[model samples]
Target: MYGRGGWARRIERRLAWSDSFVIVVVMVGAHAARFGWDPLAAVAGPSATPYWQVSVSVAVLWALQLGWARSREPRVLGHGPKEFQRVLIASWRTFAIVAIVGFLTQWQISRGYLLFALPLGAVVLVVYRAAWRKLIHAQRDRGDLLAQVLVAGPARTSEQMIRRLQRNRRAGYNVIGACVPGGSRARKTPLLEGVRVAGSLEDTAEVAMSLGAEYVLLSGSDAMSLREARQLGWELEGTGIGLIVAPALVDVAGPRVSMTPVEGLPLIHVEAPQFTGSQRVAKEIFDRASALAFLFVGGIPMLVIAAAIRLSSPGPALFRQVRVGRDHQLFTMYKFRSMYVDAEERLALLAGQSDGNGVLFKMHDDPRVTRIGRVLRRFSLDELPQLLNVLKGDMSMVGPRPPLPREVEQWDERVSRRQLVKPGVTGLWQVSGRSDLSWDEAVRLDLYYTENWSLASDAVIVLRTLGAIFFGRGAY
Candidate 1:
């Protein structure tokens, strides 16, 4: 566990075994449902084998495809969406191969069986991966399964890296120490809070060994050159310590970036974001369909809430305000009136006590908030009326935060890009830190989501919204 790979190998082995077990179960289950108690049941074509044999073959191939696709690799195992993305890719390719083989050999595969096995296997595999991820997170939270690291870079970069890793401990990186970039010119004293400055960059590997660190992270900044990086790699060749470069490029989605090795120099290229395409169309269709179903379920509750609000406060039950939508278009955003009718009139008087991200107005306990309004805001029931906005094509189920024009007027280049996609009732901002996020961080999150929008990510944000609401962190 203290070796270069740390606890990753153990987790990988467990994943491999469990993946095989679940794949086999889904395959056999599909076959049994389609052709029960029929190991010798003839298939549709002359070249086709028995249904049981075909199921076995497909199961083996599917499991192999998953491994071949490297879906269970250590880097992707415990964090982010890459693990789930690769699972889908592997499943799709496996079924595609089966389809091609059936077409070529006239082996009539059962459409129902394929449909059942594919989705079932995919769901099971993804859920299993998610379960493992949760276990990894729990283990890390318990101070186990953590990969100790020695960061090598300038003081500022090392501190930033350490803080980020420490903040998101679910990623499993534990920075034990750090080394500065310059040789003797750099000070060895601890400059960072709670992190010791071990030595210079040239002695990074030695420091890593002395500290028993499993990984060495090199911050790719101006302090390190190509020769220095290569030399460091050579020094750590036999040391059992993994070297990783944290490139200055940050916060963009992984799918938009690619690395190419051109004559031993890794050139990173970022692809342009595609805002209009089939995916956008799919997002729209999904939004409206899901909105309709949600409205069906929440219709009565919304009426009840409206009645409650009307009884509690002498104001209209619904609040309508103008907000910026995709491409900077204007739209009327609706929400349950969670404040008194005179709330806006009292805004200027409370400006000095604003608890928001500066650009927007927010207060945890404002005098204008009705008793029920506070509860509604806490659970985010106040945003329920935006489903009508989604149905009216003015909003989405998940996208950038619906910004008031007052906020948009203060936009920078990054913040302006936030409106490239339609605003949402709940967004990365809602799931991330809500009103507690700084203005810059909030804009950055919105910009990232707008540029890297995906149906899968949208769904992820929506699911996370449930937890965000439940925890009620930074909600106000």
Candidate 2:
């Protein structure tokens, strides 16, 4: 626990140094470009303020704004989009203030200098933070620099929380022990394989202190009242220990969740999912534009693959199949032919030999795949034709997986929610594990994306998809 705090402080210091360096470089560069290197001679009109002095002041204020924005806060440092968003907001606000001040004081600040420095500094700062985060994530993956947590809840809820924390190592939570309602009496009993009962919920703070825990996570099923929770919070005050209440909401993004205090009680507000808006229009525009651009750039390679398929297989170069799209609309999905002409007929014989999760049919060595087709599938070159689907408005660059018609037939209402968004050529499930994911896990990822779709998230998925294809992760 102490180590985690030290690590966070180390990261903060590094970020501060990086931010200062970037600000100095950008400001100095902008000043030199706008005015000559002679600092004393580069004076503003009327005010006679030296441009170098203005540069120094702006640099100092930019650094201060980053701190004021809480961009270096431990809670947001190592994960999620909040850290980057905060940094950007802080930088923007600082510039806005500078502009307003310049106008009122008639300082005659160089617009070119301001414009150049602002964007360059922001980009450099964000890149520096991302590099630091990557290093931290690498450390955490090896079980270092993680917060030691004591979970206090019902056995079932505690178990679930432990599993989730274990699965997402990047979240940086390491569950050391659990304290249930009657955990004191079962101190020797194991809650999960390695996790043990630390103490009862009443002794949560004590248990956490004894275990050197940095956080006490309370599950929704914990038998503690709000008053008791408050008392626990008070007890742990000044101990460098924090309390986390695990709400029942699952698969929700941070931007959609808000906390409001009413009558001294904290109330959580979850915004309803939105499917149609200007954002949707923006996404559609992006998809079509990107699809058209990629199609043009990839035309030569796609034609080469088409020729290879023609020579290796007896069937057509392109294969078209029916897939269920957004709002349960059926569309003709296109792919390069990867299977033998009789592969569909052979499915009946190989039905019992499937290595895939129950819904999707997959085989590691299906014998039906042509030699060229194997290479195409491994690198996802077979899906190049989907660019046309994206251009035609039948798909997106990133969204839920395109489901087969037969698979949709077995979906319950919860699973069917994936149809709320357009299908994608590559998505969370594709980059995450592809064929390695079970049907339930795939559905969960798809549903999560359906509910929390954003252009930024889509951009992230697109970048990850390229890496996944290059490495052939979970590809047969």
Candidate 3:
């Protein structure tokens, strides 16, 4: 076990060191290409040091850059672009320092070399970091270099966390088991499925040491006081085990979280959700312009699709279904007829064989779907008519996914929160897994958007949706 742990640690260090080294190598290469081998030879002619000395100086400068950035620290890895940002800052800082020193000392350094090297360093570092991250994720999926965590929480929260982690295995958390605070319950739940009970809160340390847990996660509502938590931390100190506290706040975005220290107490503040006034105006303008442009530029494609539907199937080219929108208002959602006109009539007959969630009916290979319809649905061409809905002020450029009236009727109370703003043609759900998502997961994404809508976020979702549609992920 110790050998395996040491190997994981070594791999972590190598990834960081190699990334910094590769960045420096590219920077030096770009500098050499921009300015010839003897850039300073004009001023220091015949008295210049050997070429190897110049290479050694560049290597020293690169090492200094890595030290200044602290890129080797493990705290900033695996998430966020902060690590990349720091590397860029360090590279630029090195260039500026060198340039200033050279100018002050009247040393003849090549401006051409410095200019090319800085950008080259940035591009190379970004590319290398992305490639390495892909490799790490691939290995993680195979259960390599993952953290074995023991959850210390209520049975319900622990069960939910385990299920979520299991569903997204690439996240790299292997939940070994749970340590319920009040001991196990008689009524069996999925909580203890394939997991041994390690003991209650008082025996946390014993369980941790025995199970060889690398990390311990405390659920927010678990029965542990601040003092008790501190004691637990002290006990686990110097054990190479990590402690994570799960906050009670759910579906909140990073931008919405603010930590303030007042009188030596840290308090977390959550901002209210608002997508109105200037934001609403901006969304409206965006929708109107995009809708108009698509309608005009895409007129030919729309007409051709209409003709194909008419030829392949004997029905109107367009299909309209009632959908619930903002403020619980109803609007006619438009799409190309992917099924026969009597699709609704046929739905009842196929109800028992429905492959969709209990609330939504879907079939992977429904006989009602025509050849042209399947093609259109694959690339999401059928969703084009909804652009008109956006132009009509019935929808925004981006919001929660639009829901059918029947689906809306089955939604939980919190689901109605999505109706606080107009529905959209694409949303977080569409960009995420779309139809592949469980009903609960879909609702969670929609609620997250509703409770934390931002103009920047909307723009990002739209861009991601474009890529998702082209790739046809989670689309039948």
Q: Return the top candidate by TM-score.
A: 2
Candidate 3 clashes between residue pairs 3 or more apart in a chain or in different chains: none
RMSD of 1: 3.5
lDDT of 1 at 8: 79
Q: Write the per-residue lDDT of candidate 3 for residues 325-430, one digit (tens) a residue.
A: 8999999988888888888888888988877767778788988788888899888899898988998888876888888888887777887888998998888888
Candidate scoring better on lDDT of 2 and 3: 2
lDDT (10s digit) by residue, model 1, range 1-476: 34344477877778889999999899888888888867788779976788888888888898888888889787676677778888988999988999998999898889988888988889888877867776887888887778888999877888888888887777878888888866356445665676778888878888888989888999755677788889889988887889899978777774688899999998888888888989989999999999999999999999999999999979799999998898899999999998889888899999999998789888888899889988998899999999999999999999888888888888777679877889998888998788888887788788889878788898778867876898686876
Give candidate 1's error at residue 436 in angstroms: 4.6
Instruction: List per-prediction Cα lDDT, in the order shown.
Output: 0.84, 0.87, 0.74
Better of 2 and 3 by TM-score: 2
Candidate 3 accuracy as TM-score: 0.73
Candidate 2, residues 419-460: lDDT per residue as tens digits?
Answer: 999999999999878999888888989999999989888876
What TM value does model 2 have?
0.86
In candidate 2, how many clashes are counted? 0
Flag regions of model 3 displaced more than 4 Å. Answer: 1-140, 182-190, 262-265, 285-307
Model 3: residue 381 alpha-carbon error in angstroms: 3.1
